[model samples]
Target: MRVEDSPLIDFIREEHRFSFGTFYFFDNFIISEINEGELFDWNKASEVIRVGQEFYGEEGQINYISNRIHDYAIKPQDWLRFLYERQLFKTFAVVTYRKTAIYNLVIERFFYKGDIFSFDSLLEAVNFIREQNALEPANDFDKLTQLYNDNSL
Candidate 1:
């Protein structure tokens, strides 16, 4: 299914312009897919935090999933700010197919203070979160996988 066609999109608020990527927000987590070659820094990070507050309210703690679908860079200095906003996230997950992205994740692990998990697919990421939070597993996992495979290229 196309992103526009996925029912999942209906529950997710999209914050795309400010961060130079597609950010999908659910009640408890945010999934961010970095735009190709985008430089994610303090300015964009601030917008993300602001948007998260708007979606989840000021006191809510959210999980985060980085869908590393494209190559990008994160400013190391901005990690300090991320540390401050660390309260906003209960856990962090990354899904990537690239070895280079895995290397980047290792570097990120040093700066981020939370449980971090890596997965090969979005479905696995979602399942991990569900398990962590004691939420029901997705009943249509196969359909979701097919939807992603069909539309994600």
Candidate 2:
């Protein structure tokens, strides 16, 4: 299928969302945006990312996507599945929102502190992913964080 055959996810709030811009899967080392605050489920997001990258015709899309951005509300179950499915986890700097402790509860309730990242954007939020910029209160995270943080505004 052609890139145009895919769907666009302009918004992913409380559930996963995917937006189809001109971004061909293979266009860059990174794949696409992973919005947080939208239902936090690893399998679901991974599946979406994989299907979206199907047109790119590359298998490394998972690794590329994983390396791209902050994970909003990932859980310990999600973490386990992520690790067991891929065997070894990607070295991407995955993160979740600090202000909302819902998913963080799941993370800490099940896994160790080192297994996940907790930040308020003022802490250690990444300044960029794939070299894209970020904004505050998540100023150090990806620009998508800017979007997620500003969605309600």
Best model per TM-score: 1
> Once superposed on the true structure, which residue ranges of model 2 sit more than 4 Å away at CA?
1-16, 19-38, 52-75, 87-89, 94-98, 101-153
- Tell me model 2's lDDT, rounded to 2 decimals: 0.37
Q: Write the per-residue lDDT of candidate 1 for residues 78-127, one digit (tens) a residue.
A: 88677875567787889987898898888888887766799987767876
Question: Among all windows of ten consecutive residues in candidate 2, which has the lowest summed lDDT?
Answer: 1-10
TM-score of 1: 0.81
Model 2: per-residue lDDT, tens digit, 33-93?
A: 4454444567564775565446445454222322213344454567666656653312133
Model 1: residues with Cα > 4 Å off, grouped in runs: 1-7, 13-16, 139-153
Q: TM-score for all predictions?
A: 0.81, 0.37
What pairs collide in candidate 2? 9-18, 9-19, 14-39, 15-39, 126-140, 135-138, 135-139, 136-139
Quickly count the clashes in candidate 2.
Answer: 8
